[model samples]
Target chain A: MWLYFLKRLGLAVAVVAIVIAALFAMIHAIPGDPARVALGPRASEELVAAFRERIGLDQPILVQMGNFYVSLLRGDLGRDAVSGEPVLRILLSQLPDTLYLVLGSILVAVVPGVFLGTLAARHRGSLIDRVTSVISVSVMSIPAFVIAIYLLLIFSIELQWFPAIGAGEGVLDRLHRLVLPSLALGLAWIGYVARILRASILEEMNEPHVRTARAFGLSENRIMYDYVLRIAILPTITVLGIGVGHMLSGAVFAEIVFARPGIGKLVFDAIISRNYPVVTGAVLLTTIFFVLVNLLADLVIAWLDPRVRHDLAG
Target chain B: MTRNTALSIRDLSISYDTPEGRLRAIREVSFDVARGGITGLVGESGCGKSTLMSAILGLLDGAAIVESGEIWLGETDLLTLSRGEMRRLLGDRIGAVFQDPMRSLNPVLTIGRQMTDIQFRHRLSRRTKRERAIEMLHKVRIPDPAARLDRYPHELSGGMRQRVAIAMALMAEPDLLVADEPTTALDATLEMRTIELLRELQQEIGCAIVFITHHLGVVSELCDDTVIMYAGEVVEAGPTRALFEAPRHPYTDLLFACDPARIRERSRHLPTIPGTVPGLIDVPPGCVFAERCPERFAPCGRLHPRPLRVRGSEAVRCHLHDPEVTS
Candidate 1:
């Protein structure tokens, strides 16, 4: 199993390198002069040229990419376009906000999602099950932005349950301000997790081991929660990691719709302004984070479910 | 229900609600598993053996309806017990091992955990439960029982998993143990060894076992009593030797005839019962095997013959064995 994780780690490293390379090439593919795009049209020609030279745009594309890779390896994210500060420092400032939002949304999705899923599976084919199915499907059918708009309309605009815009202050302030955005971002994923967990629970309940459990006279609660749920929760765990990774990379809708100062918003602002250093650093960090998270999820699942190790090893 | 019997299944009828319609799966099946003995419930595929076992364990799905029945374990009617009541009776008074040992034990759980988990019905400490688990594993002849405890089900071979399953089932020292074709997925040697293990365990534990299988050889070789099922009905039931020797039901006789050992001359084709068992959806009011029976007489086609008591504790549900109908 350790060997399996070792191989996965190797694979994740390759994936990170590949993602960084692809994003670098994609940035280079942008049609306009990045220096002019950064300094804007009114800036002096000499300033644009100086900016291009500073970013190594005069160098060959391969050399430029090699430079980026080297600097990335050395933990240098280069300078911000306007502030002349390290891109890494700016991202470090933004990381906690994004982490809080993303992780908080995951909690929002999972706690209710797993609870509803368990309830649905326990009372499958009943009125409660039907209601849960309808709710989850309806939520899943709507896109994140639309859900965001609706939540803002109800909770922010009308009810004033939470402030609509900006990622807020410190720990409690950020958590308080995050409530709506987290809901908007995670509502659909809650449906996804619920559906996955419900199907898994239903499947687990009918398994031969479950029958054996029932025959041994395990209480229905113990059978459902302990025996069945332990196995059923595996698929949900994998899905959760993927969802969290996606959200971390850019909960673009949530970050933008709420005008939050999250990593996603920072990346979005950088991309729009052609802040090459910030964009590359933010994208690379996000890719590495996503890959590492997925690797961790796989290892956790393999630990919990030995049957998964065969597939993991392969 | 009788004092000598560990499980008494009386006039039990069960059905399943399918998309097509409600289909009768078990039709008034009756039998008694005597204490400290193995009773083999033999039948072909889809003949309600599994359904009956599920009913006995109260593990049937929502679609399954026990239309009428009484499963008596001791003086208490299991059918009358609530879910909680049945649960309390499970590991303490009854145990079960299913077919496909690959699926019978939870793949994620250690053998030790599963073994101890079943003993949750007991008021013993965790240490006592672990000790009992090791003891049961040893009884099933699993090598290095203590070390094997930490191994998960997937780590064990099919035979070893089945052994672990048996050991786990017997930890509570249940009064009755239901083996539902537990050896069906094993190789011939493993199957033989498992049957021997069951026999030795039954003798030692003094627990009645209702061994459900389709293997005639298994029944004849190991079971003290045999019940032959046709479709969803019990066609013949008695002491294994008596039933094998003077099997009165035409279905039982035909089943024995279909065995490969009975064929003296070498042939390219093997003997088979000519027709398939009828679907339970629209059962006819006649012998379940009448369509396939060569000796099916006048009354066989028109009337359903109840099991006729031909000898002491022996019965056959065939017109040939029904003297009034035959006469």
Candidate 2:
């Protein structure tokens, strides 16, 4: 197990390295001069040239990439081109809010989603199943921004339940402000997670072990929760891990709608200002996080079923 | 004749509702197991043997409905028990071991965990449960039983797993143990070993066992009484030795004659009962075996044969066995 963990970690590092390299290449490939964008359209050509040199844009792409790589190894993500703030510092400041929103959204999605899915699965072919299936499917089919806007209009503008814009301060205030955005982001995912879980659980419910459990006189609750859920949750974990990547992207729409400060908003603003360092830094961080989550999911599944672990070993 | 009945099923008829029509899975099947006796229920696949087991266990499929029946476990009619009462009775008063040890146990749980969970409803202490689990494993002759506590079902070989299943079924020391073809998936040697183990355990535990199988050898070797089913009906039943000596029903007679072990010389082609077991929806109203019964007469197609006592403690569902001699 230790060897497997180490091997996975090593492979993750290699993947992240390639991702970072690709992000660098892709960002540079876009037709734009960061220095020129930072300088106004009315700025003089000489000032622009000096600005380019000051930011090391005058160097060759290969040299710049090597310097960037070295500095990244040293834990420096460079300065934002327009704002001149350290990209890493800006990201660090934004990281907590994003983490809170993402984690909260995940909680929002998984709890009720799993509950509804379980309910639907248990009462399969009944009215409850049909209703939940329709509701979840509808939620999934609609766009995230549309859901966010509706939430804003109903909760903020009409009901006066929450503030519509910006991430608020302090622990309690931050959570209070996150409610709308989390719901907006999570509602759609709830439907997806619920659907997958319902399918997985229904399949597991039919397994021969379930009959064995029943023959042992285990209650339906024990059978469903203790036995069936353990097997069914494997696929759900994989989906939820993949959901992390989706959450990050969805947070962009959520942040944009709420005008909140997080990685999503950070990336959005950086792109508008042509802040290459901040954009590249945020994307790479998200990618690394995504890879780690998927790895965690794999480990979890292997832990659940020894057969899978044996397969992995061989 | 005065032997105590452990589990007696009477007038049990089960049918499955489908889009096409209602299919009778088991048709007024009646049988009884003597206390501490192994009663063999044997038939070809799809002859309602499994359905009978499920009905006894109260684990029938969603589509199935018990049209009429009483499954008497001692004084209690099992079909009349509430769901909770039934749940309490299962694994406490009645335990089960199924075929295919590979699929019978929860793959994700350790053997110890699965056994402990079975004991949990009794509210035994964790330590006591663990000890009981190890003790049961030992009874099944699993070597290093204590160490095997942490192993998953798949980690054990097929024979070892089946033994574990048997051990689990015997763990609660129930009055009845329903084993549904428990050795069908095993090799011949392993099958015999398992049957021996089961017989020994039966002696030690003294639970009435409903041993379902298609193996006549198993019936002869392990069962005290044998019930032969053909197309969801009990065609013949008697003491194992008596029935084998002289089968009254033609199907039973044909089944015995077709036994490969009974063949003196190796033949290129083996004898088989011609025609298939009829589909549940297509079963003829008269004798279910009439289509394939070589001894069928004019009256065979027109009337369902009732049980007729052929001799002491032996009966056959055939017109030929009738005292009036309708055939």
Candidate 3:
């Protein structure tokens, strides 16, 4: 099992490597020179050239990437062009706010989502099932930003239940401030999770093993939770990895609407000011987060399902 | 009901609501599973063998409707019990080993966990349950039974998996053990071994078995009594040897003839019964087997023959054998 875990972790590290390369390539491939943008259009050619040489923009893209990799190994993500502050330092400070939002959203999405899915699956054709179905569809149809703005208008501005701007200080305050943003970001995936899980449970209900479980004279509740859900939840774990991506993108909308200080807001500001190092650092961190969570999800799946453990071990 | 009667199905008619209209899956079928006897329920595919098995277990599909029936386990009718009561009785009173061993046990669970989990009604301690699981596994002749408990279903070979499934089913030592073609998926040699294992286990446990299969060779050797079902009806049912020697119903006779083992001549093609099974959606207003029956005589196409007593403890459902029978 440990060997299998190491193999999966190795695969995840490789994926993160590819993602870093892609991120670097895409940013560099964009129109306009980074050197000119950093130095400003009014800077003389001599000064711009000197600046470019200083940042190693004068070298080939491969050399620049190689230099970046070496710097990454040294725990340096370079410095912000304007503020002259370390990019990794900036990201680390700003990351916790976003982590709170992401983790909280996942909690909001999964707990109720699984409960609703199990309920709907149990009462398959009932009024409650139909209601949840319609609601889930509507939630999926609406954009995360729109939901964020509406939540801001209702909860933050009108009701004054939560602070409308900036991530709050301390754990309790931060959690309180993040609740709305987390809900907005997580609402769409709740629908995805519930619908997929419900379908999965419904399908698993007919599997031969489930029938055998029933014939074992297990109570419906026991059979469902122990046998059926154990099988049904595998696919949902995979979707959760992809849902992290959705929430990351949705974080942009959520942080902006709620006016919270997070990696999303930090990246947005860095992008606007052309703070390339901070942007690269934040993107790299985000990619790592995505890869790490997926790897964790895979490990959890392996632990839950022995068949997968054998397949991976092989 | 006799105390020896482990399970008794009486005048059970089951139908399914299909797009093509109500498909009559089973029609007025009846049988008894005597305690300590292995009863073979053999029939073609879609001939209501599975339907009857499901009904006996009280785990019928949502689409199926029980038009009329009573599945009596001792004095209590299984059909009359509520879901909770049935749930309580299933693993304790009416244990089942399904057709496919590979699909019978929960794949994610260890063999021990699945075995012990079925003993919910016993209220035993955790260690006691685990001990019982290992003991049952030993009874099924699984090697190193204590070590096998930690392994999942996929870890075992097909034969071993079937043994695990059987061991799990009988963990509670249920009064009736339903083996639904338990050895069909095995090779001939493995099938024989499984049959032997089942017979020995049944003798030790003294539980009635409703073993469903199409393999006549296996049934003849394993079952104490045999039931031949055709088109959702019992065409012939009696002592295993008696039916094999002299089948009273024409359907049973034809079915016996189709057995490849009975082929005496050196022929290119193996024996196969001509004509397909009748569609259950629109059953003919006559005998269910009339269209394909070799003895399709006068009134055969228009009259549905009622089940009649024939030889000692044997019953037949065909117009040809009827001395005085009614629809």
Candidate 4:
């Protein structure tokens, strides 16, 4: 098991490295002048050159990448080109909001999604199953932004239940603002989770163990929850890992719609302003977060299913 | 003979709604199992033996519909009970051992947890449940029951897991134990051990056991009475020894001839029944087995023969076995 974990960690490190390099190259490749954007369009060529030198962009791409890696190793992410503040500090401050959004969204998706999915599976061919199936399919078909806009219009504009365009007053207020956006993003996610869980549970229900449990005279509820759900939920762990990655991306649109000051909004601002440091920092942080979330999911899956760990260990 | 019947099925017919339409899986299958007797229901795959067992336990999923039947356990008709009532009766009064032990046991949970959950559901106290689980584990002959209690299903071997499942079923000392191909998945030695263990457990508990399997050898070894099913019908039933010695139904004879031991004893070319069991959707009008029966007569394809008692307690459904006919 230790060997397998080490092997997976090694693979994860390699993947993160590749992702970082690609992101760096892609950011550089975009047709824009970060120096001009930093110093303003009216600045002379000399002023732009000075700003480029100050931000270390005057160096060759390879040298800049080398310095980025070196500084990363030393826990420094350099200063933002526009604000001239430490990129690491900005990221550290914003990281919690993003974490809160991801965690909250996942909780919102998983609980109701699993319950509804199991219900659909148990009451298969019933009206409830059909309705849930249709709803899930419809929710999954629509993009996150569309759902976010629809939620914003209904919950914020018409219903007036939540604040329209900003994070609310206190911690509770922030959580309240987070509720609508999280639900918006998680609506589609819940659909995906429900569908996956429903399929898995249906498949599991047919397994010999399920029949055995039923034969044991276990209540339908007990059998469904204990035997059926336990086995069925294994694959959902993998889906959840991928879902975190998806949720992070979805949070970008959600952050824009809700005007929440999360990493997604920061990245969006960095992209619009062409702030290389901020963009790179935000992208790299999000990538790392995605990788970490996936790694955690892998570990969770291994914990739930010994077969996976045994296979990995072997 | 005075012993109470553990399970009594009368005119039990089960059907299911398929894409094609409603398809009957079992038709008018009736049998009674006396307390403490190991009654075996044997047939080829898709012959509704498993379906019959599922119907009896009220475990049939959404697709299956019990068309007409009275599954009586003691005085109560199990078929008439609500889901809540059935749930309460299950595990406490009737236990089931399934075919695949690995699938039957929860992979994520420990043996102790699985056993204790059943005990707890039956309202046995936690401490007593633990002790009873360990005791049951010991009874099933699992080595180092204490250490094994912590182990998950995957950690144990197939045979050991099967024993654990058996132990769980026996925990409540249910009045009726339904074993559906319990030994089919085990090796030769494990199979023998399981059969022996089951026999010992049955003797101790004195519960009526309904053993469902396709293997005649298993039935001969473990069952007191035998019911041979063919295409959703009971074609033959009698005491195990009597049925094995003189199988009246052509299907039963074919089943015995197909047995490895029986085939080995017959120096001539081994006999095999041609064709598969008919699909439930398009069952032929007359006898379901007429297409496959080698000794099928002209009337065999035109007349459906109901089960008729021949001699003693033996019953056969073939025209040849009819008392009015002389072969």
Candidate 5:
């Protein structure tokens, strides 16, 4: 198991490196000069050239990429083009807001998804199962943006239950303002998690060990929650882990919709002005986060299923 | 229902409502398990041996309908009990071991945890439960029972898993143990050892066991009374030695004829009863084995024969044994 962890850690590093390279190439692929964009379009050629040399953009692309990699390793994410501040410091300020939003949304998705999915699977083929299935499918079918718009209309615009604008001040203020956005962001994924959980648990219910449990006189609740849930929840954890990237991306739109201060908003602002350093740092961090989430998922799966340890060893 | 019997099954009928038609899985089955003795229920595949066991356990599939039956354990009819009542009875008053040990255990849980979970309803202390678990594993002859407790099911071999299954079932010291082809998946040597272990456990625990299997040799070695089933009906039932010595039903005689151990000389090909057992959808009105019975006579095809008491405790369901209205 420790060996499996080491191998996965190495693989994650490789994935992050490849993603950083891709992000670098993709940023350059856009038909715009960051120095020109930072200066006005009407700026003189000499002025633009001096600006390029000042930012080290006058060097060859490979040399620029090597410089970016070395500086990234040294914890210097470079200065923002528009703001002229250290990108890492700016991201650090934005970090907690994004973490609160993303983590809140995931909690919203997982808790209800688990309960509804288990209920659906328990009363499978009954009215509850049919109703839950229909609800999950309908929710999943709708796009996240559409759901976000609808939630904004109902809770913020029509009902006036929450403020329709930017993230509010203190801890409680942020939590209160986050409610609608998180729900909007979370509903689709809640449906997905429920669907996966329902299928996984239904499969577990048919396993021969469940029959043995029944014969052993274990209560239905004990069988479902303790025995079946323990085995079935592994796949759900995998889905949640893989979902970290999706949740981060979803938070971009959510932040835009709610006008919140987070990394998503920072990335959105950076992309418009072609702030190369900020955009690169944001994408790089997202990739590293994604790779780390997937690695954690793999480790969790190995821990849950012992046969996986044997397979890894062999 | 019968007096002083550990399990008394009377006129039990079960059918599956499939899309094609209603398949009669078991029909008019009756039997009794005497206290502290093993009763072997022997038949070929699809002869409703498993269906009967499921009926006894009250664990039939969703599509199955128990048309009529009374499964009496002591004075209480098991069929009349509520689902909760039946659940309480299991692993306490009754225990069961299934055919495939490979799939019978929860692969994710350690053996010790599984055993503890099985006994959780009894409200025993954690320490006491662990002691009982180790003791039961020792009873099943598992080596290093204490260390083996912490291991998962996948870590154990098929035979070892089966021993753990037996130990788990017997933890509550049930009065009746239902073993449904428990040794079928085991190799020959393991099969012998498993049956021997069951016999020893039965003797020590003094529990009535309904041992279901296809191996006649096992029945001869372990059972005091034997019931031969055909197409879900008990065709012949009596003391094991008496039925083997003088089988009243022709199906019983044919079954004995196919027993390789009873043959004095080895043959190139083992004898088999010709023709497949009729499909459950269209079970014949007369004797179930009439089509396959070599000694089948007149009146064997048109009219159904009820079980007729022949001699001692022996009963046969055939026209030859029916003394009334002789043809």
Candidate 6:
């Protein structure tokens, strides 16, 4: 099992390396002058040229990539285009906010989503199942931005429940302001999770072990939780792992709509200003985070299901 | 001795609400299994044999509704107990071993955990439960119970898993054990070993066993009394020796004739029961086996025959077996 994980880790590292290279090349390939953008539109030609030389923009693309990789290995993510501050420092400061939002939304989505999904499966064709199905489908069908805008309008503009723009002062305050955006993101995910889990549970509930559990005189709750849910929810864990990256991407759009001072807004500003260093750092950090989350999920799945470990070992 | 009846059923009818409508699976099924005796419930597939077992165990699904019945296990009517009460009694006093041992045991749990869980449910101390689990495993004659306890269900072979399941069922020392086609999925040697294990366990535990199967050879070998069910009803029932020697019901006679051993002994072509068992949804009004019985008469198509006592020790549900009838 450890050997299999090591192999997977190797493959993941290769994939991430390829992704970083591609992202670096693509960002630089855009028809624009990074030095001109950095020095501002009003800067003299000499000033722009001097800025380009300082940043090694005149070097060959391969040489520049080599330099970037070397600096990346040394934990130096270059300088921000506008502030000339270390891009790594700025990213480290903003990392927590993105992590908080993504993790919170996932927690809010997974618990209730799985619970409702299991309930729907166990009482399939019942009124509760029908109602949950309709609600989840409706939530999923609507676009996230639309939900975010609607929530903003309701809570910020009309109800005066939360601030209209910017993350609030303290951690609790930031979380309070984040409630609408997280829900906006989580609403769509809850529907998807519930749908997947419902299908899985329905399939598992028909399995003979479930029948055996019932025959053993296990209560409905015990059988559902212990036998049915344990097996059925395995697929959901894998899906959740894959969905983490998507959720982070969604958080970008959500932050923009809510005007929260997080990584999403930082990325938007950097993209507009052509801050290549910040962009590269943000993308790399997100990729690494995703890979790490997936690795953790894999470990969790192995722990929950011994068969997976056996299969891996075999 | 009279008080030793472990399971007594009377006029039990079970039906399910399917898409087509209400379908009767078993009708007026009645039988009694005395304590410490193995009662073999024998029938072909779709003959309501399994339905009868599920009904008696109170394990029928949501769709099935018991129309009328009394499933008395000791002083308690199992049919009347609340789901909680039934659950408490089940696996403690009444154990069950299902067909397809691969599916019966929880794939995620170890054999030891499965056994100890039942013991735990009955509120046995953890240490005692653990010791009893190993003891039960030994009782099933599983080699190296201590080492095998840690192995998951998939690690063991099919026959070994079946033995583990049986051991788990007997962990609580239940008074009645239901073996539902316990050896059907096993090879011949494994099947014999499983039967031997069951008989030995029964001898040690002194438990009443309801062994449900289609194989008459198994019934002849292990059962003291046998009930031959046909199309949701008992067509013939009596002492195993008497019923096997002189099967009065034509369906029973045809079943015996169809056996390969019997056909070889008679040195004749195997007699096959013509036509399939009728669908439960539209069971015939008269005799369920009338369409398949070669000796069936016109009256067999119009009137359902009640089980009549024949020759003191046997009961045959046929017009021909009625003492008043001369035919």
Clashing pairs in 3: none
Here the TM-score of candidate 1's chain B is 0.97
Report per-candidate DockQ.
Answer: 0.82, 0.78, 0.82, 0.66, 0.67, 0.56
Report the C-alpha lDDT of model 3 over A16-59, residue by residue, as the tens digit: 77877887788777778767887788999998898777666788
DockQ winner, 2 or 5: 2
Query: Per-residue lDDT for B95-120 in model 6, tens only?
Result: 88989988888888777777676664
lDDT of 3 by residue, B225-317 (tens): 999999899988998988788888878888888898888989999777788898998888888888888878878888888888887437777
Task: Report the C-alpha lDDT of model 2 over B209-237, residue by residue, as the tens digit.
Answer: 99999999999999999999988999888
lDDT of each: 0.87, 0.89, 0.87, 0.84, 0.88, 0.84
In the range A27-122, model 4's lDDT, one tens digit per residue, is 888988898876788999999999999999889998998898899889888898888999989988888887888888999889888988988987
TM-score of each: 0.96, 0.96, 0.96, 0.93, 0.96, 0.92
lDDT by residue (B1-327, candidate 5, tens digit) is 555589988999999999989999999998889988899999998999988988788788889999998999998898898889999998998999988898888888888899998887767798899999999999999999999999988889999999999988887888899998999999989999999999999888988999999999999989999999998889989999888888888998889989988877778998889988988898888888989989788888888988888874467898887767374
| Model 6: number of backbone collisions | 0
Candidate 4 error regions (>4 Å): B1-4, B264-270, B325-327
lDDT of 6 at A51: 81
Say which docking band candidate 3 falls in. Answer: high
* Shift of residue A99 alpha carbon in model 3, Å: 1.1
Candidate 5, residues A244-296, lDDT tens digits: the string is 78889998999999888898998998988888888888888878777887888
Which of the predicted structures, 3 or 4, would earn the higher lDDT when compared with the native? Answer: 3
C-alpha root-mean-square deviation, candidate 3: 2.0
Model 3: CA > 4 A from native: A1-10, A29-47, B324-327
